[model samples]
Target: MATTNLNIRTDKTIKEQADQIYSELGLSMTAAINMFLRATIRTNGIPFSLTLNEPNQTTIEAIEEGRRIARDPNVKGYHSIDELKAALDV
Candidate 1:
């Protein structure tokens, strides 16, 4: 198989970070780029989700807190709307 050079311009910091990460993963930048290209072709798309609906940090923290509360045995749980309302004095 024949190979050719591909040149791209990117932010210096981003390139540095990518280089470190690829190095840690035992891949060259060329190999990582090849993998990404192959996956993109195989999927007929970007090979990952691209979305604008991501939650903010506050929302993420709130979700984690809610999960923690649900799992904590010491936290009070109400059986129904009436019970929850009574507890909240609503």
Candidate 2:
């Protein structure tokens, strides 16, 4: 196989962050980029989801309420699923 060079310019901070993450994942930036490109060709697309699946306002409010409940020690927490079900009178 023959090889060639490809150069790209990216934000320095982003590149540094990506390099750190790739290093931790046992890949160099070059290897990571090649993997992404190969996957793109294999899948005939970006090879990952690019769409936003954000929750709506009501769902966001409910999620926030759940978080609040999770942080409250006064609210009871069951040690087991059965206990939770029993508390719910299931």
Candidate 3:
């Protein structure tokens, strides 16, 4: 089999973390990177979707409010699924 050298640049902190993880997994950094490259080539793209978007603040606030409401001790509990559905008018 033919072999080639590949060069990549990444954040120092991230690289250090990856090195530690790979070492613990019993793989050298070069072997781990080569495995990733081989998988990418086989799939013709990244193995999974990569996103950098932040969560919507309004949606997060709504979820937090719902959690607070759910945790209220005085909140009424439904006796059955049917009762809960009826209470919600659903």
lDDT (Cα atoms) of all candidates against the true structure: 0.97, 0.97, 0.91
| 25-81: candidate 3 lDDT, tens digit per residue | 999999998899889999999977787776688988998998998899888988899
lDDT of 1 by residue, 28-78 (tens): 999999999999999999989998998989999999999999999999999
Model 3 steric clash total: 0
lDDT of prediction 3: 0.91
**How many clashing residue pairs appear in each of the predictions shown?**
0, 0, 0
Worst lDDT 10-window in candidate 2: 48-57
Clash number for model 1? 0
lDDT (0-100) at residue 46 of candidate 1?
100
TM-score of each: 0.60, 0.59, 0.57
Q: Cα lDDT of model 2 overall?
A: 0.97
On residues 1-90, what C-alpha lDDT tens digit does candidate 2 reach at each position? 899999999999999999999999999999999999999999999999887999889999999999999999999999999999999999
Residue 65, model 1: lDDT of: 100
Per-residue lDDT of 9 in model 3: 87
